[model samples]
Target: MIPGQGGIVTRFAPSPTGRLHLGHAASAIRAHDFAVTRGGRFLLRIEDIDGTRSRPEHVAAILADLAWLGLRWEGPVFQSQRLDLYAEALAKLDAMGLVYRCYCTRAAIAASLSAPHGPEAVYPGICRNRPRHEDTDAPHCWRLDVAKALARTGPLNWWDETAGTIACEAAAQGDVVLARKDAPSSYHLAVTVDDAAQGVTDVVRGIDLFAATHIHRLLQALLAVPTPRYRHHPLLTGPNGERLAKRHGAPTLAALREAGEDGRALADLLRAGRLPTGFSARNA
Candidate 1:
C-alpha cells in the first residue's frame, strides 16, 4: 500500500560508513527544512545496510552532526534494526518472476569485452541466463530483470523538482542487484522500502543519485509503494570540480566542529546557497 496519504514527510538517510561531511550537511539541511517549512515530519534513517562498512560511532556522529547543524528529525530509524522489513520486501520481489540470481563478480564484469555502457559499468546480463543448479555454492546476488520488471510495471516516470518530468530508463542500468551477498538489500531496494515505511512524501538529495531514482520509481510500482516527490539538488563539489567524497578526504563535520567552525553559520550559508572557500555547488 502507498504511504504519504497523510501530511508531507521528508528524510535524510545516510549510511553510517563514514563521518558526516559538508556534502552530507547540505542534503540533511535541505530535507529537514523542506519538511519543517511545510509543517510536516522530518525523519532520519541510518542506511547501515552494509554490515561490513557501517560503524556504530559513525551513527552517533551523524546525529551529533545534524543536531549541530540545527536540524531536527524524528525516529532515527536504523536499517540494521529493520532487516525483517527488507527481507519481506525482497521475498515479495522474488516471488514475482522478475528477479534472478547473478553470479558475476566485479572483476569479471570489468574484464568482460562487452565494453563500458555508461558512467557506471552497468551489468550486461552476464549471469541472467546462466544455468541454475541446485547444489552449487558459488556466491550469487539477486538482480532485478529490468525488462521483465518494466513489463510488469509498464512505462514509468518520476517528477524531479529540478529537472522536471523524466522517464524511467532503468534498462540503462541493466539488471541491478537488489540483494548483495554481503547485504540483504541494495540502496535502490532499501531506500524504496524505507521511504514507503516512513511515509516520505518528498525526497531531497543530490543529483548524483538522479539515475538511481529511475530504478526506485520502477521498484515502487512493482512493490506497490508510494513514489515520493524528488528534488535532486546540486552536489557540493570541490574547487577541482569533483564531487565531495570520503575517498577525496572531504573534511568531516565533526572535524570542522573540532576546528571551531560555527555550525549554525555554516548551515546558514548553505541555506543561502552559498559555500565556503574551496567549495562550490554544481548541478547535473
Candidate 2:
C-alpha cells in the first residue's frame, strides 16, 4: 500500500520486553498524530518475538499506557501469533537462494572478527557458504545473503519524509538474520512482512532505526512487499544528551503516571515539541 493512495496507515510497534519509557511515548505520540491528523488508521502491534523476554504484564502495561495518553489503535496484533506468516515469507526467500543457515553464535562471530567494530558491524559471512544440513532439527538460524539478494534487485531507493529519496545500502548491514534458531522471525523480517500485511502506507518510527530501513527496503523487494513512506522522527533524550532507555534509568510511563503526571498533558507537550525539564528531542 502507498501513502496518499488509500489514505495513510501507521503503526506503533513496541516490544513487550520492558515498560514503556518517555522515548517510546514520543514515538507513539508522533505516529498517532500523523494518522489521526490525516484521517488515517493507527495500529498498535506487540513485538513479542522474543518469547523468553516478553512479558504479559508488559503488554498490558503498553495498552494501558497508550490509552492513558489518549491514543486509540484499531488492532493490537501480536508477533507471536503470526509465526506462520513469517515462515511463509522466509520460505519464499529460501527458494530464491537468498536464505542460508547460519550456525555462528554471538561468541563465535565476535572471536572470528579481527578487530572491534561498531555495534552494527557487518556479519563476516562465516556461514554464508556452509553446507546445509538435510536434518530440520539442526540448531541454526536463517540469514539473508545480502550480496546475492542485491544482485537480483539491483539498485533501489525509498522515500523518506526528512531525507527525501534515499539510496538503499543494504549491503552495509551484511547478511542479516531472518529467523533465529529459537524464534520464528527476526525484527527485520517480521516488521517488513507485518507492514505489508497490515497495509501500512507510512512507517513512523524513531530516527535511531534509520539505518535499518536499508535492510527493510531490500527485504521488501525480495518478498515483493509494498514499500511504505518512512517518517523517522527524533528520539527523546535525557539531561546528559543520551537516549532514554531502560538501561539508562529512564522512568517508565507507568511510573510517571503513578507520580501524578497527567498523561494527556504530557502527550500534548510532546506533540508540541515541548519536552519536560531535563528532557530534549535528539534529531541527530
Candidate 3:
C-alpha cells in the first residue's frame, strides 16, 4: 500500500531545464502557501526524467531558487532515482495489454495523414495497429492504448478546485507515450506514479497543465491509485501578454537575486495575489 500522509500534501515539481523565473516563483508560492497554511507538508520534486537535457547545474539552481524564494520542504524527490518504480508501473500496464510498442518517429508522425490539427498535434496512431512482425529495427517507445485503457477503466473524472468536476478526455490525447526511447518514463506515466507514491493530496500547478490532468486521471484509475485534488492556478504572463518563458526573455529569479531583490518580499506579493510591474495572470 502507498504510505499515507494524513493531512494535505503538496509538491512543487519543476524540471531541471532552466533557471527559475517569475512564473516559477508564482507557482512555488502558490504550492508553498497552500500546504503551509493548512498545516500540510510542502514537498519538492525534481522532474528530471529527460536525462539527455537535465543538467546538474540546473537542478542546483532550482533548489537555490526555491530556497531563495523562502520555500521549504521535507525532502526533494528526484525522478531519476526512481527508475525501478516507473519500470514496475510500465510492466503492470504492459501486462494489462494497455500499452504497446510504437516505432513512429517525430517526422513520420508529423507527416501522417491522420496527424492532428492545430497547436496540440497528438499521436496519429500509426503504430497502434501495426503487427509485431511488421516492427522494424527502429528504436521504439511504449504508448498507452487509450481506447483499450478506457475500456478497462470505463468512465472516469476528477475534481478540480476552479473548474469543478471534469471528465477525463483521455481519447483527445490519443495514444500517449508511457515510456520514451530516451527516458525510462514519460511525463504522464511518471507523474501519475509519483503523485500516488508521494501521497500528494493537492496538486497545485499552472493552468497550462489543466488539460494534462485528464490523461493523468485516467492513469490514476487504471493504476488504481488515489486521485489527488487539483488546482490549476492562472499562468503568469509578461508585459506583451505572452506567457512567461525563458526564450521570451522572462526575467530569472537568479537575476533578481543578483540585483539584491528581497526574495521573501517577492513571495509575500505572490501570496497576496499580486503581480509585480509588468506581469499578469490569466488562464491558459
Candidate 4:
C-alpha cells in the first residue's frame, strides 16, 4: 500500500472552519505531489461536519487558495452532503452493539478525571452501560466502545511513512465520540467513512494527527473498510518556532495572496523543502 503503486489515491481533507493557512498549504502540496508524481489521483474533501463553525464563505476561500497554489484534485467532496453515508456506517457499528450513547459533557468528563493525562483526557466511559430508551430525548452523543471493538478486531497495526509500522492503541483514548449531538457525524467517524468511500489509498497530513490514526484504524476494522497508508509530515511553525495555529495569529494563505506573495512559488518552495522567511518546519 505505497504511493505510486496500484493507482495511489491521496487526499487533503480540510475543515472549513477557518481560512487555509500556511500549515495547510504544506500538507496539500505534499499530498498533491505524491499523487501527481506517481500518476495517481488526488482528492479534496471538505470536513464540514461541525455546522456551528463551518461556513460556505470559508469553503469558497479554501477553494480559492488551493487554486491559487495551482493544486488540482478529483472530487471536492463535502461531508455535510454525505450525512446519510455516515449514518449508515454508524448504524452498522450500532447493530454490532459496539456503539453507545454518552451523556457526559466535556467539562463533566474533565472534572471526573482525577488528573489530566495524555494529549487529551481519556474519556471515563461514564455512560458505557447506560440503557438506551427509545423515547428519551436527552442530548447525547454516540461513542464507540473501544474495548469491545478491539475484542472483535484483535490487535491492529498501521504503516506510517516516517514512523514505519505502528501498533494501534485505541484504548488509550477511551471510548471516543462517533457522532455529536450538534452534528450528525464526528470527525473520527466522518473521516474514516469518507476515506473509505473515496477509495483513498494514502493519507498525507500534519503530524499533529498521528495519534488519531490509532482510533481510525480501529474504526476501519469495525466498519470493514480498507485502511490506507499514512504519511504524517512535519508541521509548519512561525518564526518564533511555535506551531502555526489560528490562536497564535498565523497568517492565512488568503492574507499571503493578498499581500502579493506568489502562491505557486510558495508551493514550489515547500515542495523543495524550503520555507518562506517567517515560517519554519518541525516534526510533530
Candidate 5:
C-alpha cells in the first residue's frame, strides 16, 4: 500500500525517448493535480523498454522538465531496470496457459490486414492453435491467448474522466503482444508489471492510450493483479489538428524552453486557453 495516501494511487508513465512536449506536460499536470487533490500517491515510471532509442540523457531530460513544471513524482523508476520483474510475470502467464509464443512476423500480419479489413488488425490467431513447442531455437514473440484469457477473465471495465465508463469485451480486443522478439519485453507486459510493482491504483494518461487499457485489463486478470482506474486526457494537437509529436518542429517544448520561455507559461499554453480549474485529466 502507498504510504500517506488514501483512496487510490496514480502514476505518470512516460517514454524517455525525446524531450517532454506540450502533450506530455498537460498529462503530467493533470496526473499531479489528481493525486494531490485526492491525497494519493503520484508516481513516475520511465518507459525505456525500447532500448535501441531510449537514452539516459532523455531520461534526465524528462525528470528535469517535470521538475521545472513543478510536477514532482515519487520516483523515476526506469523500465529497463525492471526487465526481470516483467519476465517473472510473463512466466506466470505462461505457466497458467494464458500466454503463448507467437511466430508470426510483422510483415505477414500486415499482409493479412489487406486480405480482410478487420477491427484494428485483429490477430488471426495463427499461432494460437499451434502446439506449444517446448524448444524453439528460432526468434519468437510472446502473445497472450485472448480467447483463453477472456474465458478466464471477462469483460473489462474502467472509468475515464472524459470518455466516461469505457468498457470493452474480450472478444473485441483480441490477442495482444506481451513481449517482443527483438526486445526483452513488450509495453503491455512491462507496464502491467511496473504498475503493480509501484502500487499504482489509478492511471492518468492520454485518450490515445485508451484502447490499450483493454489489453492491460486482460493482463491484470491473467496475472490476478488488481486493475487500476484510468483517465485518458485529450491529446495536444498541432496547427494541422494532428496529435503533437516529434515530427512537429515548431511549438515544441524543447524549442520553447531553448527560447527562454518559463515552464509555467508553457504549461498555460498546454491547457489550450484558460488554466484548467478543479483538476481534470485532458485527452491527448
Candidate 6:
C-alpha cells in the first residue's frame, strides 16, 4: 500500500548482529516521527536474516536501545520465524517458470570480475538459459526470471521525499538471487515478502540501500504486492568519509550509555551531524 493513500505504517527493521549505533538511532527517530505525525503504526521487525551471525542477545540489545531512545514498536517479528512464508513465495515464482536454480560460486564470480573484459558480474544470465541443468538437481538457490517478472509487474517509478523522483528498469539490475544456496531465502526476497505481509506503507532508510530499491521494486511487481513510499536519508559516514559498516568498528549504544551520554544529545547530534557539545568544524 502507498503512503498518502491511507494512514502510514512505517517500520525499523534492524538486524541484531551488533549493538545499535548512532546511525541506528537516526533512522529510528525519523521513522518514529513520520508515524507519530500521521498517527500511523510504527513497527519494529528484527531483520536477523543471517542466522549465522545473529544472536538472541543482539536482538534483545536492539530492543533495549530503541526503548532507551523512546521509540516503541508494534512488534519484534524475527525474520527467522518467517522462513516458511518466504519458501512459499519462492515456490510460487518457481512454478510459474519465473524462478530458476543457480550454482555459480562466489570464487568463480570473483575470477570472472577480475578478467579484463569479462561479462558484467551481475549474474550474467548464466542460469537463465541453462534452466534445466544438472545444477538444478544439486544444491542451488533461486533467482527470479527478470523477463517474466517485468512482464508481470510493469515499469516502476516512485517519488522520494529526500531523493526526488526515481525510476528504474528491471533489465538494469539483471537477475538477482532470491534465495541462497545454503538458505531458503535471500535478503531481497525476504524483505519484499515481509514488507507486504506487514503492510508497510513508507520505507525510510539510509541512502546506501538506494541502489537496491530497483531490485525490491521488481520483486514487488512479481509478487503483485503494493509498493511503499520511500525516503532515503543521508547516511552516516566515518572519519575517513567512508560509509559506516559493522566491521569498521562502531561505537555502540550500550557503551555510550555507560559513558553517560544523553539520548537526547545523540538525537540532536544525528539531526545536526555534529557533536552534541556544539563544536562545529564548519562554523569554526
Best by lDDT: 2
Candidate achieving the largest TM-score: 2
By TM-score, rank the candidates, best first. 2, 4, 3, 1, 5, 6
What is residue 189's positional error in candidate 2, in angstroms?
0.2
| Deviation (Å) of 255 in candidate 1 | 1.0
lDDT of 3: 0.88
State the lDDT at 163 in candidate 1: 82
Q: What C-alpha RMSD separates each model from the true structure? A: 3.1, 2.6, 2.7, 2.7, 3.8, 4.2
Residue 196, candidate 5: Cα error in Å is 1.8
Identify the runs in model 3 with alpha carbons over 4 angstroms from their true place.
1-6, 114-119, 133-137
- Worst-scoring 10-residue span by lDDT in model 2: 1-10
Off-target runs (Cα >4 Å) in candidate 1 are 1-6, 116-119, 131-135
**True-structure lDDT of candidate 5:** 0.76
Worst 10 residues of 4 by lDDT: 1-10
Total backbone collisions, model 2: 0
The digit string of per-residue lDDT tens for model 1 on 1-284 reads 11232387889899999998999999999988887877788898999989889999999899888888878778789988888988898889878978888877788887784665544777878777765564266788889999989988889989999789999898888899899988888888889999998889999999989989999999999999998999999889998888898888789999998898899999999999998889998875
Sort by lDDT, best first. 2, 4, 3, 1, 6, 5
Candidate 3 root-mean-square deviation in Å: 2.7
lDDT of 2: 0.91
TM-score of each predicted structure versus truth: 0.93, 0.95, 0.95, 0.95, 0.88, 0.87
Per-residue lDDT for 21-48 in model 6, tens only? 7667878888877886787888889988
Point out where model 5 deviates above 4 Å.
1-7, 113-120, 268-284
Per-residue alpha-carbon lDDT of candidate 5 for residues 80-161, written as tens digits (9 for 90 to 100): 8888998899899889888888878877777766576654678878778778655375798888888887877667676767
lDDT of 4 by residue, 82-182 (tens): 99999999999999999998878888887788875654777888888887774257898999999999999999999999899999999988899899999
